[model samples]
Target: MWGDRGRGGYVVHPYRGYGSRREAFLMGRVFRQTALSDRIPRYGVLRDLADVLRRIIRWGLPEVSVEVSLGENVTTVTTDHDGYFDVHLLLEHPLPDDTSWHHAELHVVMPQAEPVHSFAEIYIPPPSADLLVISDIDDTVMYTGVANKLRMLHRLFVKQAHQRMAFPGVAALYQALHAGPSGNAKRPILYVSRGPWSIYEMLEEFFQLNRIPVGPILFLREWGISWRKPWPRRAEDHKYDVILHMLSMRDDLPCVLIGDSGQHDPEVYARIVHEFPERVRAVYIRRIERKPDRERAIDRLRDEIRHTGCDLMLAEDSLAMAEHAFEQRLISERGLEKVRRESSR
Candidate 1:
């Protein structure tokens, strides 16, 4: 879900979902927004600040009814006190055997009011896919100093999507990974981020602006200060939980995990490798700092996962990663050449 709108005295916020052939899940929020909040622009520092403030002061519609349908399967659910609603539906039959995304519709079925309609998509990986690519967003794809709160906030509020700079060669590398060894296979790419759900639209715009392969964005919970709660809440084991969920959902597909050394990626990924050794093919961590301690720590993680036969590469640039991918037969020579050509620019 990218944006929210008010209709028939209700505010509806839709969120994206990912699934396989036989099952799918849909999520969204129902709330009421203030007039001032509704006026906030979609870009600029002022707009960013306003978004944070609005999320804190927003009014949630508790016990609201929601209807979700994909083909003949339909389900009704109620929003919690926080205005969050999640509906898991079992499809009557499998989705079509195609690489394209499937569509699902959601309705805010409130009593004595016109239904508010929103749409979301479900991505089904093709059978020809040999590997899945799961990546981190903040420091790995875009330049967000997640280790430094002040710089991160500055980058977030001051830069528009077009103004945000992606790391060199990262887009080409991801595109190659998306098109696997055959250069035509539509390998599924999933992005996991520590960012809140409020920035979903901004992130989507950033991906498009930078030519990154779009995928299901799994974001952590929203955190904001409210009258009832004066402080923001922190998520515990969020990355681990989300990654585990994704791995469990697509157990048959081997995955290549991509992240950076900025935060707890090494630890989380190391644990995943230990637990599901056979499911992981390789782990790529973009080097962010030149600190000896960080490198030593990542090396230790590497040693820990070495027994799983999943190679751990701490690369300084996307070109290095692309070369390694080609060597591992994950991407073709043409894809590697494309990545090299794009990175040289």
Candidate 2:
């Protein structure tokens, strides 16, 4: 989010959250914005670069008191050194099951400034959910060349949401997975990325522009930008942690993991399957890096994981992944047709 600017010169940023019937979570950063630069000017490449710089130029309001309320329950929490506030609330009553999303309000309490109020959207997956879909963003869904750091950084900062490209059939495939076999299953899709939290709004807009189903939670990394890691973050460990937390929270739900072989996705996913063999049904790794050795390694890893009761597919396109998902009963025939149509275009 660009954040809601208050007269007190402080901004309240509320992120999308997810929870179960027992507990709910919401996290955001409280920061100071000098001027009202919320809306980016639509121009050429230079204008998009300015927008990217604006997000990076942030001053966090540290140790600020933030109040979070879920239904009738309310709690107060303080921001961390980085101005990031993570609030966890225990619910006495279960949220409504008919709907997948619940609303929470966050109010910034400060003596020096006017009270700032922001709202966060929290999602509680229905008990009838068929599966959980977790996917990576970098090269799996978007066309960010992870191997080419210079080009990746250029596209990341110099391009706007409409200018960026989503992989062919990715939007259709993800929508089908979200709808599930009955077409209303509302399976929760959690996105994990190696990018920083600053780029959240851009990514959200990208999904909207591309018509991809937006998930409730997007797990982003905190690693600073560098040549080795452009939209840098901790290594594969960040993704592993996010996936582990999701699977642990939903013991009854089986998940399908999607990533690309451009980096260490195959290795991290293999490790997850070993740990939560029963909770993960399928792992789909896209062929981003077209090297004989890497492809062979993924193939070997796939064969090794077969006995763990989870199937790993190394596919070249989203359609191939959908076909395998259809065969596994993870997606419907109609969904496969949609993907087929999307891929052909």
Candidate 3:
């Protein structure tokens, strides 16, 4: 099923990988573009509406073969029904130790058609790094009322990236975490969101505009809206699966998870702490909701995780989180001061 313009193409989404001298697991999606106008910027209300309609109408090519190459190693895999591919390869030689991201190439081959080539990048944190950061984008960093559907739609569709407002002091806090304790370690920062793949570019632009540290954006799934299914589907298991995959990637590095109390972060994070008792250094849940019941629930969860040696901070704001991070030795004194200065402004 080709698109409006009778043109068919493929897109290899940005992804992340973790490995050393032996093997690496690389995963990403190859979208079958029915329309070639996916890159057009949508500014006005009509344009944004058109963009959403176009994305909803687009289709994914299934059972297509794809080749991935990095350094001297190459592997072939077929796209699943949803056009997603995960390739695991044994490296001929270990990736360079000096950099965090390594360059790779992807080629999507179709029968009786020319192959499409795209550039891809994979991140590998340096060995000297002290900690890893897993963050949630929606209410945690950006000012999206995720708990309210109508308000979230207004903020997402009406406001452009530059016009969107980030929570105060969040960028500074994230920069501090990216620098680690010594202020030089380039720690990996992975962002996970329940948003669909259609808004991936918009979120990327949002991060760039807000100066938040960028990493692999692991979105849950694409919003598959059809006449047979009008309402968008939610994957409740997405966060647990993604976080577990990231933790398994690097067992040596303890991590700090940051999310907001507006959703299921506290419950999901509590489970992670219980399962990986030794691998979690801290979990920061920003207090976005003021409900007393939410506070009581989180307090009980804190008590449950107290014996695991994982510090759970239900912070009222970014400053509180930064202060606790400094006290726990997760971030440096200078980083804490930066957060304070930024929050004051």
Candidate 4:
């Protein structure tokens, strides 16, 4: 029988005799648990590896899902294992006909978990015809737990949790970059991040919160136990591979490179400049530390960069870097103006 409980709570005890109260209670508990599992944390571990494996093979592992709805039509795509997804939106009525402001939504769903929807506004404008910005995200956009030596060692060796900090003004800068002129929209922004591959959600959340431009993403895979090799080129090689691939994808337009001085950005960017000196218009290196050794290294890198023939801007902040990018003609003048205004506010 249905029963009333205190404080507006209701208890269901159906009079049907197909099942005993104990069985009903057990079933209720199971149902509640299933619902609860959806709210699990991003870092939450599953109890059954078999279930996770099955879900991955069947429904496909949930990476990031971006859905764009324009009136009757909708487009949806989930990122791959590398946390990169490609979406090609086809319109029955091309741009002008379907010119109503479109709504873009992104949701990242973990297996048996609640979908984390973007907290920020997602807007999709007509394709291209605007300045393009390709940025690196790890230490460039978000703090990848690398600044702290102890934490870095722990994440790299012991328990891996690379999704720790958020870089200041990263989201603001991206929002500005994504924005276009009063009538036109910004070209697609490509995000390339390094390693671990597990922080896809964290990175996505940062983007959503900041309302960063969403387009193609490239993530390098973790080397696992093989990270101990003395070769510093291991990580840089993956990024270089990405750079080369991107160069091939785009015909001749120069890209804006945003990276940090923490790792091998100087080395990699220097190499890119040497190979395609004209294709890489400007490099923005985030200067986090100012130790004497780092200063010397930066000086050495500056000398090396001078040889490559690409302009370099070493800024302690993303806004500064964005400004430098705009001033150097790496991005549109409006892009830099918008970022500066937002950062000042």
Superposition error at 193 for model 4 (Å)? 2.3
TM-score of each: 0.90, 0.93, 0.90, 0.57
| lDDT per residue as tens, model 4, 1-345 | 111111121111111111011111000000010122443443434423322322122222325454544334466665555333444444454333243133333445455655444312223333353444667776776665677866654443333223344566676566655553432445446677664433333445456556665543434344332236532334657778867765664544556677888887877877888788767767778887777887677667667767666677778786787776565545466666666666666
Ranking by TM-score: 2, 1, 3, 4
Per-candidate Cα lDDT values, in order, are 0.80, 0.84, 0.79, 0.51
Clashes of 2: 0
- Compare the candidates by lDDT and give the number of the best one: 2
**Residue-level lDDT tens digits of model 1 in 1-345:** 365432224677767777777778767788776644545565667776665455545677899988887767788899988888887888786667754577777888677776788777767677777788889888899989888988887776555577788999988999999998887888888888776665666788898888898865455476654678754578758778877887888888899999999898888899999999899988999999888999999999999899889999999889999999999999888889988998899
Number of the top TM-score candidate: 2
Ordered from best to worst lDDT, the candidate numbers read 2, 1, 3, 4
After superposition, which runs of candidate 4 have C-alpha atoms over 4 Å from their true positions?
1-132, 153-165, 179-185, 222-234, 307-309, 331-334
Q: Is candidate 2 or candidate 3 better by TM-score?
A: 2
**TM-score: the better of candidates 3 and 4:** 3
For candidate 4, list the clashing residue pairs, or say none.
1-13
At residue 287, candidate 2 shows an lDDT of 91
Judging by TM-score, tell me the better candidate of 1 and 3: 1
- TM-score of decoy 4: 0.57
lDDT of 2 by residue, 5-75 (tens): 22226788877999887888888889876553446455655556665666776777888999988888889
RMSD of each: 2.7, 2.8, 3.6, 14.1
